[model samples]
Target: MTGTPEQVDYQQLAAEIMERCEVLGRISADPDHLVRVHLTAEHKIAANQVEEWMKRAGLQTWTDAAGNVCGRNEFGRGSAPALLLGSHIDTVPDAGKYDGPLGVLLAIAVAELINNSGSGLDVPLELVAFSDEEGTRFGNGLSGSYALAGAFEPAWWDYTDADGITFRQAAIDYGLDPDKVNEAARRADELVGYLEAHIEQGPLLEDADLALGVVSSIATGTRHTVTITGQAGHAGGTPYDRRHDALVGASELVVGIEQICSTGGTIGTVGRLQVYPGGVNVIPGRVEFSLDLRAETSPQREAALAEIEAAAAEIAGHRGLGWEIEQFYTSHETACAPWLQGAIAAGIRATGQSEAPMIWSRAGHDGMAIDKITDIAMLFIRCAGGISHAPQESVTVEDVALALEAYEEAVRRSAAAAVAR
Candidate 1:
């Protein structure tokens, strides 16, 4: 963490990235502006935006078949593995300020410093901007990072977005050839390590008044689609005892998930629901819903999911109803490399913060996806009031500056390690 401290005017670079994000015009669920619906034009806008930023930094574009943007700087290439810094550019519907943009910008900032370094350190660095981590278009997150880690399976080409656009079609529309997606992926051996900087998305550091957190593990998630069916009858019904109501049963399922997660760190949600053939007078013959569960470990996550599923089945059996279930996805727990964690802590010490370097991630990230294939690490900046995913989402500019400093140090250490090989 020493060595004359590679320096740059971080404040200027951060302001530039923030301003670029600020000018993107309310990038919500617009087809033309790439709202929830992927109009294809959206990728162009984002790519061009990212391109403009890197170009301003005097770096050239290095795009791939998956639409991932790579910017590279060669310092007379020595025998060093490339240091990789990555984060996605896609956002949830009507996303807020710093969720993904900060990571992309910070990576660019790191590159800018390396580009200007007169010392010509032993390593070469690459700044990567991943596309479609939000899953707003395809309902599956981390597409670009998946490809970069060689984790994107070919079957995903058939995935369809909300508008009936398949992932293959969307890739074609985005100026990438579906036939060449396999070529888009990186060699697993070529990457040395990866790092991402993201807003904490929780209130931990905010409440504790800490400047930054070096993430120790990225939390895992389990998702399920559940359906319940029962007899349809008049709202008044033939008789209370004789009537079977799916709506009423669904209500119970919702509460059951809540009850399972009341223990604190465990989390569950029945976020989406639909009742068939809608009418107030109807008894609701069918109901479909979703289940979301999260935990620090697989056992805890599996237990929570199993409990919820069991409760649904029991309620159905007691009410003379039928149910069906389909699992959507599950993420395995991703742990940070301890060596990388220590280097980040050293970065924190450089910034003069003394609190035990906090480390935890409940939100899913591109880092988690990459962890499935390579060594990965992350840093979390506190979000205000423990709130995120809304326009009101915020982080202190001062804290952001500290993160820029810390991540730069992290990038340097990672590069230094890679160059040692």
Candidate 2:
């Protein structure tokens, strides 16, 4: 049963990982689409399934108080500081199969290979399938990782889902004691570092014709809700000069957000919008919308946000409307630790690349939260057309096979680095 990197059947392993992702894909809240939110019935089912996979990988498994599915392979080295590998299992509505599940499945595959190899590592391996990362239910993402990092916010307990169920109530329904969530926190000195493998979710890798790349950093992101209020009146009765249309003001601000952010070299998205008084003859008196802003650094993002705020004020004043903006969530930019980056680079080289390609992630990840407790690094697998967060997301079996090889090598190199330290 002895195995090695070369001895591993990567094609078979890749197939299994993909198939597992599909299996998870089917365990969603929406029957017609993939939508597994945190602390829901579907989440409980997926966590149990992941726990089973972890057991098969020769790891001691448990679900943390925060509902994170966690497993550890001590390799007979009890009390040893472990190397953590993981990704979130919770996904956005109608999410792609590979976005979060692929990383967890790949980590399991690596653990299985390492266990069968009988080449015990200097450090133990820990795998986590985080319960919540998408914030699809609560609008505050990375709750699982934040809990593990000991950064869980007390205010999140009051956050409610669309069904008006508070997070605390949801936790209780999920068989978790909301007051005991802090028990899931892991100390900084208890582990080595964290690593995650994810689809590139962009066109860079596919465009460069590379199977994988190392992430240099993750972008800082901020999300806000903006509301504009005005007087509702009959659309045909209200004169254009007398009208203070909230929707028009909101629209102007949205366009201003795009213009300012684009010119400032930051990214801005108005993903959701709602208008009150829904009627063909009725003018929208109130408008609410979401703004997701991101940039490589805080200063860049702040400057863009400031401009957006000024524009909002101006539009509100000109339209004689009242406007308010409230920030809901934010994650700071995080750099991949140099040493861990080197380990990932070495792993990429093991996959036959003379040089490892480095890219910065514009998307958010659990690593942004985990970075508060430990160093973090990520390996990106190229997806077809760089599409993700949708059913169209895809990755070739050949690419996943190479990713498995790279990810396993990364773990080995990380273990070696830990020993040397």
TM for candidate 2 is: 0.95
What would the per-residue lDDT of candidate 2 be over residues 97-160, giving only the tens digit for each residue? 9998999999998999999888867899999999999889998889999999999998999999
Measured against the true structure, the TM-scores of the candidates, in listed sequence, are 0.92, 0.95
lDDT by residue for model 1 (83-160), tens: 678777776665676788778887776666656655544566677878878777777788788877778878888888
Most lDDT-accurate candidate: 2
**Which residue pairs of candidate 1 clash?**
28-35, 29-35, 29-36, 30-35
10 residues in a row with least lDDT, candidate 2: 1-10
How does candidate 1 score on lDDT? 0.75
Clashing pairs in 2: none
Model 1 residue 355 lDDT?
Answer: 65
Query: What does the lDDT read for residue 364 in candidate 1?
Result: 89
Which ranges of candidate 1 are over 4 A from the true structure? 1-9, 25-39
